[model samples]
Target: MLRRWISTLLLGLAAAALAGCSSTRLVDGQVESFSTLTALPAPATYRIERLPSQQTPAFEPIAALAERALARVGLQRDDAAPRLLVQIGVQASSVPRHGPSAPYAFYGPPWAFGGWYGRPPGVFGGWYGPPPWAFGGWGMGGPTPLYRRAVSLVLRDAQTQAVVYETSAVHENVWVSDPAVYGVLFDAALNGFPAPPHGRRQLRLPLPPPAP
Candidate 1:
């Protein structure tokens, strides 16, 4: 009986490995989008509006990823004659195997990516950049810990300065690397584009191919 059980477990592991080799991992998140713009502005151009925290060069990589997402969604980047103002935010904090997490814990409820709750002004505004905790060995050690991560984008009319669209995407996972999954997060955030569905929904997109 013991021998049979061992063989069965080995076969199951082998089958899973084979499946992974040919399959792409999915980056899944909960997305919520709201849009007041009935129609996109003519020319459909936009520019990135960096927050105070996003002014540094450290944020370039995220901006690049966001640009790709924008392009995919049919929005063009034109700083000179932009019709839209775009702002993007990414934040993550470590989550223990057990206990309350800080980023979204203290409040009534935790907020996830692609969505936002009506929290105080400083909560999301203050900590929208890189996390203070190091992510050095999150995946290296046994029983990798997970992170509660979120991404959001705010779009405003350039001329009127009124927010016309807002979308956010939040996720939780063991992967601590941001750049690797950012494009997908942004894509998920902007899933419905100019006019998304009314309420929150889940999205799963193919993760980028593994680094060579």
Candidate 2:
């Protein structure tokens, strides 16, 4: 009886570990842009404009987070005669899950997880991209509902009003409310900045812990 109990305990512990490993929140999506420029002009001041579609009060905090991210990419906020205008938008929607294919697979092409090009090879090291069917696989498992939360950042020339750069980050999960997750998304959105990676790719960022 004692031996059987020990085996059961070990099994429980292993199961819990696997659950923790698989429960990670993954942000996966393609970033498409029209510009071939490799980087944004240096030392440019920007102003944030919230679209009418994002009029909710909850967006105030997310906007602040986006500002911080923009700063990280060397863009500053200048309301007075700003050189660049940044339009921020966010949306959340319920997507139908079909078959056993993972959610990420459904959203991106098969080569999304293959490899990274454009910049250098080692710049994205130490970070793990999405796994095969990590989100949810089609036909392999029953239909599991998932929510997609996406944020977009668009940079335009303040004077010309011509869009210079735009990118978006998308995440899939059962439910997401943590603000830090948005930070990760914004970072991914601005990964390549004015010059983004060519073609469709799966940009992976570490999931932030839930807010207390």
Candidate 3:
């Protein structure tokens, strides 16, 4: 009878874990942001800018996600007559689920840009990968891979063209479809925009279901 009770308890625990994993997944994004402005200018109007490499139609979805994040932070997109020019950059890759390293595909280019999170010069298409931590593992330690995603937002003065606010966020998960979680990652990056915290921080948020 004791053995049977033990078996039932183990089965119940397993089932609960499965349900939790199948439900909304939690995303832990590492966020680092910097800014010079204490508050946005009057009207808080801006336009989205992209690099030459990010001008493709394939990048539109990612850009749209960033725009949504900006709006959430009380910024408006005004291309006709704007006060700020917010540039967006993103990076993603797939790695071993157990945090092992192999030849992985990296998005973006190797070119360097000033005011990034200081992750070498390769700061395009991909998140500036400096943190060596991965959480919320999937596949139950099986052969399924993990996905690493990073996003960077650069807010500049529209008239002077000088960078005023810079921020980025990175997250790792088993979900390969980025659209499902990119929105939240952007939210983490711009958590306290205009006057964000000084050091890196960890953010935990629930991932919404994929769009129907």
Which digits, one per residue and each the tens of the lDDT, describe model 1 over residues 97-122? 44334343321122222122343322
Clashes of 3: 5
Q: Which segments of model 2 are wrong by more than 4 Å?
A: 1-26, 36-38, 96-143, 174-177
In order, the Cα lDDT scores of the candidates are 0.70, 0.63, 0.71
Clashing residue pairs, backbone N/CA/C < 3 A, model 1: 113-169, 113-170, 114-168, 114-169, 114-170
On TM-score, the stronger of 1 and 2 is 1
Local accuracy of candidate 2 as per-residue lDDT tens digits, 117-180: 2323112222222223333433445444565567777788888888888777777765444466
Cα error, residue 18 of model 2, in Å, equals 9.0
* Candidate 2: residue 128 Cα off by (Å): 24
> What is the Cα-based TM-score of model 2?
0.65
Off by over 4 Å in 3: 1-14, 97-105, 108-142
How much is the lDDT of residue 179 in candidate 1?
59
Backbone clashes, each candidate? 5, 11, 5
Model 1 scores a C-alpha lDDT of 0.70
